[model samples]
Target: MTAAVDVRARLVDRLEASGVLTPGWRQAFLDVGRHEFLPDVFWASTGDGYERCDRARSPERWLELAYSDVAIVTQWDDGTSSGQQREPTSSVSMPTMVASMLRDLDVHEGHKVWEGGTGPGWNAGLLARRQGAHNVVTVELDAVVAAQAAANFRALDIAPTAVVGDAAHGYLPGAPYDRGILTCSVRHVPPALIGQIRRHGVLVLPFAPLFGGGAVARLTVTGTTVTGTTATGPFTGSSAFMRMRQQRYQAPPVDDYLPGDWPGDAVREYTTLNPLNVVDDWLASFVVGLAVPDLYYRRSNNGGSGMTTLWLFDTGVTSWATVDFVDGASRFEVRQSGSRRMWSEVEDTVRWWTAAGRPGFERFGLTLEGGEHRAWLHQPANPLPSPRGQD
Candidate 1:
């Protein structure tokens, strides 16, 4: 226990030095140590895939993982699989990310905070300590995970109202909260959460679009709308959090997209744009995703030859395009099909991005009004032209 405490102190100091752990959260972090909430058997994807670790079998190793900056997976396949398959469904996020989100939360005394996901209850425990347990309400989707978190909270001698249900819907009974935060990322901000926060109340969450790449955002509620910018200050960083249960993607049948005669009837064309340019950078993925919301992509290469194919698919199943790149060639060939000109859209988005000097995530923002969302640049008034517009 003494060793654990020393390790915790070391971690706090490390994160504080990184500027993510501010003075406001120092004591709360110390008071609500992570080891107490984490389960005895958890998974850590230290390398390629999820690997299980048992505290009883190797206390020293478990302690090292608990105190380290990496995220610790507590639940696998949402509690459906065991021993064989090891895909993480729930976890305690990295300490630095937790601290960064908390700092952006900017909670004050007497404020009520609604937490979206209660994985292991460590974050909720920190919140409870910072703002009396009664002031924190946490919601989790899985009943078993929620029960375990409840038990963990009791063991730690902190009590926060823990609900077992969909966090995307949020906790309505405890409405009119002063602040709200989500451990999980969302493609769309739920209307219930926007309605629950009082005017001027802040809501901090990770916003992940359907395509790829994501970042945390801090929005303020006003009237029937909420508007804010993606987090950009020093401590802020990128995220790949699990999607809200309701927002999880259910990809269409592979056969439907790619018939036995794949690329059949696709209109082939050529352009000077290099396919490698957009796929290599997260910022490029984000910008292209904003411009083309309904599209997702896959890339593959031909053996040994410096040639690759970029396959694009529409979430709506209405369009598909494949861009092929060959070595030492300034131009590329694109085969596109369906009602939407998917390749043309990609080309236009890339063109616009280059014209704008290739802006970063901080230059982007979102505004939600009555459940409708619109992505914009610099400010809400300067909205980005929707993909729905003709190429």
Candidate 2:
């Protein structure tokens, strides 16, 4: 136990020396003993001496990882308990990522803050410790995680209000917060979160676009509007956060979606890139999603040939379309007998990105209206006058 405490101290010391830890943040890191919140066994991906979790052989090792400046996987696949599987569905984020996000949030003392996605209450605890406990409120989508987080906070004697519900809607009961932080990665900025912030308040979250990719975006809210830019640094890492409940998932059959028989000269292939790298390039995909909202991609390998298949789910009706890009040009087809021109949407979005000089996400800003779930994108030179104009 003493060795574990020493190791934790060393990790905190390193973080502080790295200049990423502010004075208040350093104190918070020291105060919050992560071992108390984690289970007896947990995986460590740091590539340090320890890699796998073993409660019997090394209880001390597990406890050490819990306290170190690293994240612990707590859940896998919706409600699957950590003890059941190795596939991580949810985790307490890494200390550096957590600290970086808090720094981006820039929450000062005594400010009313609303936090979305309370994993293990570590971040909530940090907010309550910095701001008054009475001034912080956190929301979690899973009841079990919420209950565990509540207990974690209670153990520390920090009484921040922790609610179990979909954070996509934002906790409106505690309205007009000074700052809002979303720890989860979202395909789109939730309109409710924007509405929940007071004018001039700060909102920080990871925002990605459909089709693929995302980034940490920081926005400032003002009377029914928000404007902000993306942060640049090492990628914070990828998270499999549950999509907003409203963003339903549906996939059409492969036959209907595929283009006519492959061209004689077509050659299929595949490649892998870090998922974080994909999110960093979200601008390319956002342009694609806006133009082609129903796009989905699948990767496959058949020994000799490998390719990624693209499908378009038509929102206008029950039908969808398919496109295959083997050698270069895309071959299009339709499936499920529907009325919407899903193919047109995908092509149009691609054309828009091409015509816009392929501007990156840095050129775009997002604005959210308070008390409502609507978000708008703004360009420095050509601000989107209205959300209706996004199409």
By lDDT, who's the top model here?
A: 1
Residue 345, candidate 1: alpha-carbon lDDT: 84
Model 2 spans > 4 angstroms off: 17-19, 45-52, 67-70, 81-87, 225-248, 252-294, 307-364, 369-391
lDDT of 2 at 264: 22
Tens digits of lDDT, candidate 1, 128-155: 9999999999999888989999999989
Can you give the TM-score per candidate against the true fold? 0.91, 0.72
Q: Which stretches of candidate 1 lie over 4 Å from their true place?
A: 47-51, 225-236, 255-260, 300-308, 325-330, 387-391
| TM-score for candidate 1, residues paired by index | 0.91
Task: Write down the lDDT of every candidate, Cα atoms only.
Answer: 0.83, 0.62
Cα lDDT for residue 122, model 2?
A: 82
Which residue pairs does candidate 1 place in steric collision? none
Model 2, span 218-307: residue lDDT tens: 777655424432211122323324344455355545555344653322223322222222223556555554344445544333355443
Which candidate has the highest TM-score of all?
Answer: 1
